[model samples]
Target: MKMSREQKYRLIEEAGEEELALLKQQVKQSPWRQKYHIQPSTGLLNDPNGFAYYQGEYHLFYQWFPLGTDHGMKYWYHLKSADLSDWQDCGIGIAPGDPQDSHGAYSGSGLEHEGQLYLMYTGNTRDNNWIRHPYQCMAVMNADGQITKWDQPVIREVPSGYTDHFRDPKVWRAGEQFYCVIGAQRENGTGSIVVYRSPDLAQWEWAGELSTSLTAFGYMWECPDYFEIDGQGVLLFCPQGLQPESDKYRNIYQSGYVIGDRMNMNTLELQHGEFHELDYGFDFYAPQTTEGADGQRIIIGWMGLPDIEYPTDQQGWAHCLTLPRELHLRNGKLLQKPVPALADRRGSKASFSGRFTGRQQVPDFAGEAYELICTYTAEDEQDHVPNEQSAVTAGQASVFGVELRTGENEKTVIGYDAQTQKLTLDRSAAGKPFAESYGTTRSCVLDQPLRQLHIFVDVSSVEIFVNEGEAVFTSRIFPSRGSQGIVFFAENGAVHLQAEKWDYL
Candidate 1:
């Protein structure tokens, strides 16, 4: 059911206690809820915002619409963790009812200064004519975890030459001054990023649009994040209106990054390389990153997209944040690996090692919520002669991989085609289907020989890290409750396989 403007903007306080309780009950009854991922208790969640390590814990917030499973009346829902693995809900960090954020509390970043955490985010307001006016607002959290908003927005007006589509401020300290890069659209409607400099976090000066090679890439860019990794600058953003090209930009909106020499703060110039996607799967967007206390760059993304309806919406809930991933710059490309803290959630373990010629299911290797690490080494053709007992003639496997969440009539295949050297994820029959027009499969060509696959499977989602995060695919699946089987297979030839699985605690 489409929500009217009144319903969409209705505050949670306006709802009766019975109504709120019923909504929570409906969400609790949903079968697709994730086992370990951070999700909203009820309503919609998107855009991981205000993620930072503060005091003695990691504090993360997301854009939340508490009343329903639609993009409406957003609040900054909060969660904190000493270790990224176990999160404690803090509830409603920033409610949107003030004049600055009358419509919603949008996305932003977190910075720790002088004993407190400063939360800077976009304050979304709609005028009487339904025109959007975004404000860069700030809120402070003390050691006691009390959050207080500023009486006025730090940035009240959209700088000239950009439209109201401007939002998502990513702030960082560079030397002695703080810098911020915000996603914006030019007056002519093309996506761009503008810079700002703040000396004390109270007064900010417009630093001008960031200079880059991408002059006309997309219509609008959202959630721009800039950071330096290993002396190289990487800018990550979600650009809307990107047309599909070959196997890239297949999603309705695209999130990716460009890596190059560190930006020249004096000139605000970013001489970066071509943009490369951060995740090549069905559900990933608005990813935000923060440097951990150990100096590791870690990221978490909304495991869902905007304007897309999911099977869980009928249950009065939607979406979750992906498991935290540690980012690294290897050979000019970003490599993402699930953080080591996630291992804290590992329960019972299973192991398998052998030459698998065809589809085989090992005992204790099947589950809906677990982590699997498998390596397939194509056997040398000269070593294995053709035999009637073998599945195919003597040669390396032409195609190989695993099937997840398999049932009698459904399975999600993550396979690698040796002939084309392409890694593909096919969820055409994984389960309940939506967005079929965008296609049900996604693939990325591998530059090196296929080696290992590290997979994290939750009740309703899967995060695949290939070859130690040289490539990654994050997607959500809606398989039936009974589809908990997993199978490994090789086609046309046999391959040496070593596998291990750990059920999530």
Candidate 2:
């Protein structure tokens, strides 16, 4: 029997304990299942949405396609958290069927207005000929958790002189006015950002456009986000179809930012600096951020890139979210550190420190899901102390770092070159290859000495924060269960080190 649209919406919107238990049973049998990450309950998950802290809880929603591992019609799956560490599934928050969002409820953000939660997202529609019409739609979630979609789109149609590529409205309140920035593409085929302002949340007016003839950005931009930090405005967005620029923009798409002292909303002009990639990793895109109740800019990103295949596709599910990170601005760059609340999961901790002359492997340093922190300096440094020793002489490379998943010729390597100031994550041998289009290695350069490395490893993912979050790399890895051994190796010179490991619950 064909299910009516109302029946389908009822089925999805009311999915609760019975649905979750079944999903848990099915997913528990998959070897690639993550223990602590926010993955899809059944099918595919992408692009976290509606990330807002409200009513003493943090609400997060994601683009979900529950019937399969592919991007079919997308729905929004909602979850709430009290501490941002442990989460409760709130079932489906929005279902597609209404005329406004018949095709899908695409990406957007959340805001708290007058004690109610307001969500603004893109409503994606396609004709039989596959022509696209996107709408900037709105909905309200009352204190009782009932979501009511507004009958019509706040911004009814695509504006003049742009393609239907306009979408992903990130809304925020600046003083008494509500402002939004949406990603768009010019008629001439360059990516840009369009600003909109509303005195009240109901009526919106076009502010202006922010684009560049100064540089060749991609043809279209997606998921544009704007915020203020330390009195500076930061614009972050994802650009598609960008040609590789040396060591940057190497992914299928890129997520980056341009810092500006201020943004002229009416003119859409920004006194900004150069663009910089947010993460240098094999898999990271479509990041969304929110300011927490404590005044920290927190961000979470989809742990998988678009148009890529993963081994987990065979297991009936795919993709997850990176751990939530707190963003800070330091020396004109964004610094991202995993929220300290995550430390509550640490159990059975161990500490190690030493002066290592060469290739040295710490005994009992092995786990698939754990957090590792290390501090070290080049051997030539005369001002350092060494404790508890492990020594060997590996010859001339002038680089230092660690190797993970070291078994059966499958290991993911993260290394830093003091001379070049380049940090790289090489996953050539991590495991099953996903796509040739996404190369096996990604790198970033540090503006200062490489003093510390903080790494978090789940069953199939790795997130590295370098030099107190001066730079970060988040990627997924597929390694055999037996490939859990970790080793630290250095070349040419000795290393003064202090390290700690904590197994995660």
lDDT of predicted model 2: 0.84
Which candidate achieves the best TM-score against the true structure?
Answer: 1
Candidate 1 deviant stretches above 4 angstroms: 380-394
Q: Which window of ten consecutive residues has the lowest lDDT sum in model 2?
A: 387-396
Model 1 scores worst on lDDT over the 10 consecutive residues at: 385-394
Question: For each candidate, what is the lDDT?
Answer: 0.92, 0.84
Q: What are the RMSD figures for all models against the true structure?
A: 2.9, 4.1
- Can you give the TM-score per candidate against the true fold? 0.97, 0.92
User: Whose lDDT is greatest here?
Assistant: 1
* TM-score of candidate 1 relative to the true fold: 0.97
lDDT (Cα, tens digit) per residue for candidate 2, span 81-181: 98888999999998876888877898999999999999999998777777888999999999888899899999987788889999999999887899999
